[model samples]
Target: MKKLKIGLLINPVAGLGGSVALKGSDGENIQQQAIQLGATPQAEEKALRALQHVVDYKNKVEFYTVSGQMGEHICQKLQFSHSIVHTTSGKTSASDTEHAINEFENIDLDIIVFAGGDGTARNVTKALNKDIPVLGIPAGCKIHSGVYSVTPSAAGKLLQKLLTGEMLSVSYADVMDIDESSFRQGIVKTKRYGELPVPMDLTYIQAVKQGGIEHDELVLADICADILENMEDDTLYLIGSGATTKSLMDELQLDSTLLGIDAVYQENLIGKDLTALQIEELVADYPKTKLIVSPIGGQGHLFGRGNQQLSAKTLAAIGKNNTIVVSTKSKLKALQGRPLIIDVLDQNVAKSYKGLIKITTGYHDSVLYSITD
Candidate 1:
């Protein structure tokens, strides 16, 4: 059997701003500030998770990657047979990512697996231009792009399948991203930069994010009524990001972060756009708390897609029973019978909430939904 050639790339700074509430780490200033805010590099850890799945197949594959944090470090750590095709500075940039891809163009690679978010996807698409198939490990904060796998381990599984010829055929997936400036200000402005050739298996790869539907105003009103009626005094409520949840905040006449987490107490917006640390601090002051979250449209993700602010520690503290999920019937229908996905970065945490859970659809209206990782 001929060994399959695979190219690896990692954006070391990718997703560094997620926990600290910076929205993204696109620029040097933002990356530095995120580190100063106590945010750590997550892309390397996420990349290692994906690569671990393919470790047993090392003898059947040859890996090519850039030097240092871009790729070589993890390859060596995992003892994978890899060669450093390009050298990168200790500090990496988008130009380094593009240059690495340009170098890979001379090699005959079966696939190029990258660990990063939408920005990394855009850079890869620009360099390769669909010249080869690519896959993404979800390591960024705002993953509105379709290029990423549903989870890090799933990326490894998909790569294994592709290399063994178990999966075939490729489809164009949208590479989308949001403006960080507007995103940090509670505004969501996404643009489709380009598309990349991804595997056709829908079970492994995520679909492009869908825009908010014009749900019936009355339904939203009913949901708000139910939430307000159930509000408990002296207890904190962590509001997750989404259009549906924002409507609930709007009904209460309280300020809300459209694409960021917020804290509420007695129906008052106490904290707008909070980080994980900020949430922990508030949770300490108000020991009793409930989390209000909504699913991502088309993707069916209840957590870890765009709401990293609700870290595993926060969720564990909030408890699953204390969590309330709200979504319009139309949104659930669009899921096409798929279970709500969870990628909280900790498998044990994601597995804690299995089986059916209730989703608050309207006033005194709820539906049982299955939760999965």
Candidate 2:
């Protein structure tokens, strides 16, 4: 059996800004701010989970990695056969990431698996000296890029398939990043830095986040009106980020955290840009809270894209039946027949989401949509 040689890279500070509601962890200042706000780095832990899924295939796989948290530590912990091709100490930056990829150029590897967000994806594309397949572990805030697997475990599943000699198709996925400055101000402006070859299996890999919004004012208003009419007294509404959900916030005459989770009670804005812990606390108090979320455009992900604040614990407390999904008809149509994706890290919670889900398209228009893990 031929061994599948893999390259691993982990960005230590990749997701430092996520749970703190900083939008992204792109700059040093933002990283410190997120830390000060009590945001914990999850890049290494997330990468560990991805690697755990492939530990059984260690005999069939070999790894080339950078020293320290970048890759070496995780490889050592997993007891995988690996060679440290690059070394780094102290704080790492995009330069370190690029330099590591430059080292990978010297080794003929089957795939380069990285743990970071879109910013890391950009660095990988910028430093690639060859057409090697890449996969992302989604350890960052803004994961709008298509190069990422839906979840860390999903990335492992893909590696497991590759090790078992499964013929997975490869395709060029766009490497996308957003301006952190604008993103902090609730404006989502994504720019395509470049593309990278990624193994394709919609069941595992995700699609690039679709930009732009529905311009049909009537449709948006109708959808918002329906959601407003259904708002019950004493009910705490946890509004998920998106244009559609923001429309509801606008209709309620509330300040919307356009890119962050917000809390509404009796149509009043109470909490803005809430973190996962904050959401859980709020749910514990209210007990009658409903989660309103919209599927990301084009990607059709109702969870695990940009809304990390809705952690598994928060979801379990809110209950699946208490959640409401809203989307424009055009957005759903653009998906063709693809079901909405559920990429939440917790398989138990994600599993409960299988089967058909109803989406509110307008004031009286609704459609049943299927969701997949």
Residue 9 accuracy (lDDT) in model 1: 97
Candidate 2 residue-pair clash tally: 0
User: Which runs in model 2 stand beyond 4 Å of their true positions?
Assistant: none
CA lDDT of every candidate = 0.87, 0.88
TM-score of each: 0.96, 0.94
**True lDDT of residue 305, candidate 1:** 71
- lDDT of model 2, residue 308: 77
RMSD per candidate (Å) reads: 1.5, 1.9
**Positional deviation of 119 in candidate 1, in angstroms?**
0.7
Model 1 lDDT tens row, 49-69 = 999988988888899999999
Off by over 4 Å in 1: none
List of clashing residue pairs for candidate 1: none
Q: For model 2, what is the alpha-carbon lDDT of residue 84? A: 89
